[model samples]
Target: MPPATLSRTEQSYLLDGLRSKPAERADRRDLHEYRMMQVDTDLSLQADGSARVVLGSTEVHCGVKAEIESYDAPHVNVSTDLEFAPWLPPSPRVQVMVEYSPALLHEHNATELAMITDTVQDMLQACYALTGNSIGPLDARQFIVVPYARYWVLHLDVYVMSWSGGNVLDAVFAAAFCAMYQARIPGTKILALDKAAARQDDEVDQDDPAGIKFITRGRKPSSSAALDDAVDFALENEWDHGRLLAGREDVPVCISIYPFEDTYLLDPTLEEETALSSSIAVLASARGHIYGIRQRGSGELTLDAIHKAADVGASYAKQLAQTLQARFV
Candidate 1:
């Protein structure tokens, strides 16, 4: 039910109970306690990496795809919002997309959906984006094959299968972190680039109107003498030979906090989230480094409240990271 649907009596009861000494929650959980979560990885044989995270009723899946791309693609500078890690390199482009299921869409309107997408994308990009200032510790040795010719580009697709309750951001980020950690970049075989051969392969399209000409890439038959030295790059078929993604343990884990009158809530249910006036999502590493902090509520927050939220997020991040890392070990 929406916040408006909460009866006045119920709201009063909630507020009184929360404000009482040793605040109480709807489920009798401590302020730092979290809902039970289930995580799985290596879910897709085709994807470089894949994982699923289930928290309360929310289920999110993250898949990692890496493709070899040329330098012809346009480059983008670091985004203003991505002031987290400041990762450099235009190649090995990383793209993140978050999509929701029809069932979830029915519960939320376009605005809510947009907000979810935008928030999740920003958090994921801060750590995983290659073009921006990334809080993620993506190592160049993981995907870079050639310096200027070609590189591995990543496509991280996060699909929300369901949203029942609890912190969706935590679920999304956890799934993505595991998937990226499990990612393996394929090995590439490269020969010297043949500039002369490429020049000779340019073909003229004769169908142009008014004597206009369009140049297109042409290929020679395998048996033709022109293609004997044309093979410049190829991928190795053996999966075992591929390199594992670097900084596998460095992805930031996020903890979302909902502040009540004089207390805070961790892993709040949908109703609890709606009732609260403010929310803070802290993206931090298990190694005791703070990546970024996002505040989404309009409630007036004191300095002490912010610090408490950060401390909670940072402390829980280590525990969450341990939980995720255990899966690989």
Candidate 2:
């Protein structure tokens, strides 16, 4: 006689067993522990800055290239693209392309594709908002070489190289942070404004060869001792751009929590994700301030669950920020 196959209900029961008393997962990791992650910075010599991140089986790459443009307002342009390996089995893919111009929005039709695009755009915007309206090290105000005349335009490109399981948002954010941490901008010096020339006339001298300067975004030190230490560190390690950027206390990180029955799982794998009833993605700073919260899935979360998830997410974000500082700085 042929062996009997388990029904859908039976299969679900078995999977639930992995999450019940005396729970056992293939990786043997605790429910709260995230998967192994590896972050490599400055991977591209051609780009201004670049990083590659591997979280569990997922891999993401980010590159930043900057140019000086004549504009009244400074802006940071972000774009994302995704490509799957041909050998892999067919699966759903999300692609987001953001342009600075408003004309690109009309190209999207009112279909599933449009929804995916909109979702991706919202996520990116949340990331930017969490980091103080800037995706890279320097904000628009700092990028301006000449007020209302010349400023730096940064183009951040992110690509999903591989996807196996786990949260892609965490991986993408990590890669982006690393890339920005390694970025350096050209040195600029102000010149006297020419009263007779047009306002659009170039006010910055591009031929200066004094050398590039590393851009830093953070609050000034509160004490003289801290300021002295920072200056000493900078003078001793002038070549270390990544360290300076990574040391910023205001840098934010993301945490994703999924609700599984009565329990909540952190950095859930593909199997756990499929079994999840609802999920929340939290973007928090190192100091545990919740900057962004996004919910998904068919099930609803109670008020208590939302608060618990936020607390858990904040703790995880703090830990992640510390780890990145230790590794990169």
Candidate 3:
């Protein structure tokens, strides 16, 4: 049988709604309201950290694993892989591998794949910057037991279970943030390295749970009090099943804005996404600073539209950040 296609009437209706104001959309959400979101963290025992995020009908799962590796620098390594369900349509399946040296560099095949990789890379960099380049509260030195020798390396993997359209970047960023929030690196104590002996001897302690110090950012009591209350409510209702993540105060959330004629809509649906003339994504810190911005889709964006979209995205980012913070708390 031939593949099914949208009927002309259906297509026309969707296009008309996309061009209309947000209130006219079938969901009746305001121009600034986002679709419903559900987030769960620490769902995988085998991984150092893991999270599953569902935004409207789109679902994504992210897992983070870490290990100690000999390195010359003190930077976190990030790798991202995006996989669609086997039943989904045929599109590019790509993986982005990045190693942070003196500069950031990535390896991928195909121009299209390269673009995807660059987009994801930019998002990850923004996330790291939003956290002040610290894993939790500890500085880069803390991540290294032996400077210029051995340090921690983190691997992040993300899988898309469903694509209902809209901005997948928002979902990806949320999942990555949740996974990183829940990630824990095992603690270690380094012994002195002996080089004068006939045989060099280096010893390190690696198997003591009591010595295991969790990577965490110190929480600010002023803002954390509200988060704590929210957490209590979530726990009571069983909405959050994972342990509270450390250093959550610095995490950020992203929001994507789709532009119709003169209106910028927040969290467009699949139909709206298809009809969008242009789009922009913004990554905002928990404190409301714009950390990163990217233009998306094939449409051109005016300078005014960019400014407007950033402002709108900031609002949504704040809301989403608070919501995710409460979940992680």
- Which candidate's lDDT is highest? 1
lDDT of 3 at 99: 23
Query: Cα lDDT for residue 248, model 2?
Result: 38
CA error at residue 83 for candidate 3, angstroms = 46
- TM-score per model over all chains: 0.77, 0.66, 0.65
Worst 10 residues of 2 by lDDT: 225-234
lDDT of 3 by residue, 180-281 (tens): 776666554444332311022233233321112211211122321121211100111221343233455555677888876766677777666756556788
User: Poorest 10 consecutive residues of model 3 by lDDT?
Assistant: 84-93
Number of the candidate with higher TM-score, 1 or 2:
1
- Which prediction has more favorable lDDT, 1 or 3? 1
Clash count, one per candidate: 3, 0, 0
Q: Enumerate residue pairs that collide in model 2.
A: none
Where model 1 places Cα greater than 4 Å from the true spot, the runs are 1-5, 73-92, 130-135, 194-231, 261-263
Query: Which residue pairs come into collision in candidate 3?
Result: none
- Candidate 1 local lDDT, 152-196, one digit each (tens): 778999998876665788889899889887788766655543443
